[model samples]
Target chain A: MNRHILSVLVENQSGVLSRISGLFSRRGYNIDSLAVGETEDPTVSRMTIVVQGDDYILEQIKKQLNKLIDVIKIISLAPNVSVFRELVLVKVSATEKNRASITEIVSIFRASIIDVSNSTLTVELTGDQEKIQAFLELMRPYGIKELVRTGLSALQRGDTQISQTVTE
Target chain B: MKAADAIVKCLQKENVEIVFGYPGGAVLPLYESLRSSSIKHILVRQEQAAVHSASGYARSLGRVGVAIGTSGPGATNLITGIATAYMDSIPMVVFTGQVSTELMGRDVFQEVDITGATEPFIKHSYLVKDATQIPRIIKEAFHLASTGRPGPVLIDVPKDVQNDRLDYVYPQDVSIRGYKPTVQGHMGQIKRAIRKLRNSKRPLICVGGGILRSKAQEELANFVTKAKIPVVHTLMGIGALPVDHPYYFGMVGSHGFAHANRAVSQSDLLVVIGARVADRATAGPGLFAKNAEIIHIDIDPAEIGKNLGTLIPTVGDAKNILQQLIKGITSLATDQWVQNLREIKDSQKDVLFEDRVGVNPKVILKTLGGILEDTAIVTADVGQNQIWAARNFPVTGKRQLLTSGGLGTMGYSLPAAVGAKIACPDYQVVAVVGDGGFQMSMFELGTMAQNGLPLVILLFNNSRLGMVRELQNDGYGECFGIDLTGNPDFIKLVGAYGFSGIRVHNDDQFADAMKTGLAATKPFLVECIVDPKESTL
Candidate 1:
């Protein structure tokens, strides 16, 4: 099995995102994490997709993605070279007895408490996948109530764009 | 100008002399503007025929073919042909009408998401929400369809967008950021291929549809001659070289010549040009040129290693790449390989035998070949008749044969001939079809009649689906759904559509009917009564 990140540039059109993700699900491939947002140009959107599969699945995904006309470009970003981040918000149960301890744990993990209730604390954190997972695990001992994470968003460290002009 | 009028103007500017379309509820405004346009429109009976004809036109002449249909069923009917062109990489731009923007998702009458339906098939599609986007969308659609491994492009126009007026501003250039197709091959790769070609004692050139699409036939022939290589063809790659050419080996596939397959197996080096090594061409990936060092030349980068992966992948335009390769190559002496392929071809020449009193499709197609010349364009429907045409039709040195090779669309020939004959008026156009596939798009006879296209409809009546039956007979004990219980009397049926019908039950009568059909100024239908169980192979 191989894990690859594909930074997809697509025309900002209705149902385009649904079409891409739907194609993956229908074709029976795994999308580990998918994050999409407006790029520098609003007319186009950038999607950072994390997928896990063997060579056959990778080739199929590449061919299938190219077939989608809404997709403008797909650049396979190397995990070692590019920086990616994920944001997670977790609400953990905290009694007055362990509130000070939980606050200390939050400070150590560099997480900020967004809201403080008498029984629960909502902490927001931003980090790489590993950091987020570790933080979630650390807070689990304090009784986790809820958890939400924005999927990975990444950008290359270089200046080149996959949006090179194609002449007819 | 109205958006519809602007569209007509844009089509005119694109030099689209002819287009095929059918009228329906959603596309009224576009059709209304077309009444006064200079471009000629051939009204097809069904929406499916419109797309088929357009693709036929594109296949015949290497220009982008235009086709149109309205929403719902009209657009849905075009799906098969769209997929056909997509698979074959035939350049076609299809315009489909949509419901008004307000009623797009409201379950409105005659409404369907045409772009969504065609998403998997087309190279690109545009759903114009704004009227001002019409001009740019039209330009982009044409460019996308005809460029870079040509395939179908669709533009779905909402009814409201067509009605709304806008200043017509056509984009002079299409600068798509992500669609750069390499035209010139990497020089280093070309040099390496030439060196490999020069060294190989048993070298073969497997030309395909891409050579025809790229109009690189002359260059390919030149390269083959200079390299002293034998040429093998896939089904879609027919006519890349003259059939009578000394080095031209016959097609390679299931129904293809045994010699060609033998050549692919024996060759030390296989130079594949512009053709996707489809399963039909390879049979299976296992024994397909396994011993040969394969060199793949294709326009699409994705297609290079998609199927039977190659050792040397040269991605670029065939003409440009061959032109570059020709410069460094002098003379490749392969007299023994050439003689070996010649012997294999000579052994397979007398394979197909004749039946005097029955309609042998092979005999029919061969007889048609005897009557027609290089100027004739034969569009074949899917199944057994297509196999006969592919196997027996002696057409070469020109882009004359068109078939739904990749998609295997059942009813393609009749409408395809309509479009081909319309595209090239002087050429003798013929539609070779089986009884099973004939009924699928037989209504296009009316389109032929209305347009006055002097086409010969060669109906091969086997009284069953020959390929399907062959499969059942070989694989299953009993035939269930392959037989046609009540096929129409084609000769009599065609007479009502302004065609002179001639029934041929004997082999001797086929040539005469073809002569008559070939000479006729109006439409003619020559029906061949083929044996029901005859293996097309």
Candidate 2:
């Protein structure tokens, strides 16, 4: 099944995030990406979780999550129509011989090499999950050593917003 | 008059009595001013407790709760409490003394940007640069914090501002640029919802916490009766309709009544009011009203079609909306549909009732129900205590049951009970908490003792995190790290806090303890040691 993006509003309290993630993990559901950040309202935080399931299991997970003490609301953004992105910093070893090829690859992907030393080069990339994954696979052959990827952060494509609905 | 006088006057304007907090260097001036002021200051062990206490005070009183702390560590400690209150939509105002304005942003001694740190968690935060603004800011803070969807607001006062002199004038009214809250229902949406309800055969009303917040119980009851629709309540919607009312179909959700869940699943037209259609309440969106054309009526427009995917989405106040709906409902009848719901309700009425010794949680709750008047509002925490109250406590009147259903805050019961007691002083309020949760805000006993608000606290001592243990048994296949080894003696704990305390070992003892505790003209704690293995949910 295609992954769906869900934004959850939860009480910003201890053990709330853990409880939600625990429920997902315990249910044997694999999460593609999950990112949490404070919303415009301090009392509530927005959790964007990328989960792959049909309408049934996704709704089931959402319902179980609502049973948590800190959870306030949940909304699933329309897939394909939504805009999603993830930030990644990857470290790879490059030499003078392959440096031009790596640079060419980096330019092709529109990624920037943030750090460069004699033995190691660090490239920072920001894009959708698929685009980042494609670049990572190409870098794999060039002795990819370490990678740090930020979980997916998403917003709906158009004027549709979470806060607008809650405000009224 | 000094700037301290201005600050004190601002507090008076807000009608702040008790502030839960620990004192420190940056706030010494405010603490000094507090000494001369009539406002009672509660000395909490930690700044976190101060916020939680303030949350409790707010939830119990319907007034904006106040808490204070010093800058740096003090402000950081209050983060959790503020976050907790923010999440639960409780109104609270937190005051943190900052380093002198001159030294701000330089990371001077005990200087932290409290306003910046708290920016993410507070509804709004102000870093006071002028003494004259203190009164207006304090007034506005309370206004902003308590009004609209109530939340925590922070005022970071620099030491200099606290000590600066200003001509104090308290504003009688508050005005803000973009904070107007809609108070009434939209007539157009109400008419549409009413029209849909009148035509539908299998209509079910799903209620949420918004009903309680709006004080629309009578309106909800009237609409249900006039429309002849059965109600299925969410956990937070508990007391919106009397639990035993003939039209009441029971609670809906994961732990909801079987019939209520089935009714929601089987209904052809769902009339959701004041509810967010939370995942638990719907048992997953796919199963909730899949066959029904949903009519969502909520004050928060975001809640409409946010979860269950509705056709008729109405956004407005519950009471106002219900009133409008009633006006539009033209003598509609679906008697056979109502009877079908009743039959379903009757069929799934069996919950496992274990009769045993040593004061079972259910028995204690039932007994408490018998002793208290029907008007008493019972606030229950999560875990065994919540389940016990849900299964055994009977809510007979309006605005009687208040709990943290969506967030299910474990330490929520005691604080919320305090708020409910303050809101309706004539009605008896009891906080039913398990041992694990009781320890979270146990210090609130001091608040009760100091305020002279008598409350009956039923502490179900299971010597474990009973709910987690149950989960472990069912899901993990074993119990580990859930049992309590050194549970606090609740009686001694209450006694230490200068309140009356009693221990109940048996059925007869529980009754006597409850009587003795309720008879005392002070707050009382009744500690009943419940068996660890038993769970109602």
Candidate 3:
């Protein structure tokens, strides 16, 4: 299986998201992660979806997504050519003794200490999937109190725009 | 004018003469508005029947059928019908009355998230929030429902929105940014398909419901005649070509004719038009047309390679694609191929069924086909009855065999026949249903009785779900839960709805009974007591 990152542009309409997610579930296609936000045009929304499937499954996914009335366009962003990032907030149980070490690890990973309490330190990290995984592994020794993640959001590195391209 | 009145006005503007619907509390205002309108409303016994009936109307008339229902359970009931229409690509517009805007999402009395529930199946849906936008939404709904890759579209209107007053002016045109459908095939792809067809010694044209949806029957006929190519069809493509046409082979697929499947398997070039090639049509995709180089033609680009690989994917409306193909290609020497197919078809012509106890359904349908007018419409319910009708009924001239081919929903025929008869009052309409399926929608007898339609109900009484029984008997060597031992006396049952019927026990009794039913001035039922041992093959 291969992981595919698809950048989809859709109408900013209510129920469009449900339509996309419902399609995935109904067709038995798995979604690894999905992030949606408004684009330059308020009437349109861009969704960055991460999925795992083979070539046939990937083609089926793209074709099926194109069939949705609200979906305007879809482009698969290649991993090497795209800039992918995910934001994760990890609240670690840090006592005064281990707080200094935790801060040192956080600085090494270039993560920010977003929030701090007597018994916990919340670290905010934004990086690609690999970087996020590495940081989380290093923080595992310090008992994790709470964790949240904004799934993989991606775009091409160059000047090419998805909206301007005509789809088949 | 009230938004409800505007909705009626929009229907009138769309040239909708009738609507199949049931009234409920949430739609009281809309029903009140309809009460004052000239459009005729057929009150179905259930909301499901309304959608099925509308489907029949749409398929028969080549127009978008309209159906209405009130919310929660009523909307939920339309689900099966909507999915059926979606699968078969039938054009229909369905409206459901929602609880007032404030009551929505609150689990109030008679409230459901219908739009969300139907998202996967519906072509497009609108949950009307702005009363002033009612006219535009209605216009767009009709346009979307009837356009490329036709299917059911739903509009859920809140009760308060229907009551809200607004000056409505229906839009003259619709332009949905994300919904433009390709109408013409790419020229380069068409040329590639033509070249492939010319080079192949054994070529076959597999037509589907898209031919009918695009009204490309004439084009298909012309193309086949000029090219001398043999033709086969999917279940939904039954009426695309006359059954008796010289070049037409039977349907292809699992329950399809052995000869037709052979033709598909043997062909070197297979041009599939307007078919998704679903599992039922292909049996299994891996081996289907393995030897053939496939050229998939469909209005929806997504369907081209969904199931099977395509050598040349031509995306466009079937009618337009066929026209393009016809313009580019000349007569081909496929005589040897046609001869081979004919020999194969002839060898499989006399399929012998086991000697059972009662009337043979195959003979009943064949005889009925002979008796009916060339333009007659037959709607077959699911299961054994559907296969029996699809195989035996000779669909000629303008005749149609409407069924829930995609969803295989039982209880479709009776109400669909109602819609067909209403749509084409001059044509003879027949509902071929099995005992189990008949009871599923027999309540529609009241709808037929009230309408005083001159229709025929051909009920095959096997007293069991024969298809499931056959599968059980084949797979597990046993049968269970397939019995309908307490099936009512169907003739007496129809009489309860103020209609007359006749029961026949054997082959000799059917033609006469059918003749009598057709001669009757009101809705009539002809129940043929089929042997429980009868198999679909």
RMSD of each: 2.7, 8.2, 1.4
DockQ, structure candidate 2:
0.05
Tens digits of per-residue lDDT for model 2, B121-177: 466677788888888888888887876566788888989888888887788998753
Q: Which stretches of candidate 3 lie over 4 Å from their true place?
A: none
Q: What digit string (tens of lDDT, one per residue) describes model 1 on residues B1-537? A: 999999999999899989899988899999999999899889999989999999989888789999999999999999988999999998999998899999989988988888887766678777889999888888988888888799998889988899999998888998776576778898888888988988898999898899988998889888878878899999999888878887899899887889999999999999999988789899786668888998999988777777766878898999999999888888788998899888878877554555434777787788787788678899999998999999899976463889998989999998899889988998889999988888999898888888788889898887889898888889886687987888877777877776787888888888988889878888898888877768878
Q: What's model 3's overall lDDT?
A: 0.93
State the DockQ, from 0 to 1, for candidate 1: 0.41
Query: What's model 1's overall lDDT?
Result: 0.86
TM-score of chain B for predicted candidate 1: 0.98
Instruction: Write one digit per residue (lDDT tens) for candidate 3, span B182-265.
Output: 998999999999999999999999989999999999999999999899999999899999998899999999999999999999
Error of 2 at B22 (Å): 3.6
TM-score for the B chain of model 2 = 0.90
> Candidate 1 at residue A162, lDDT?
55
Q: Model 1 chain B, poorest ten-residue lDDT window?
A: B348-357
Worst 10 residues of 3 chain B by lDDT: B349-358
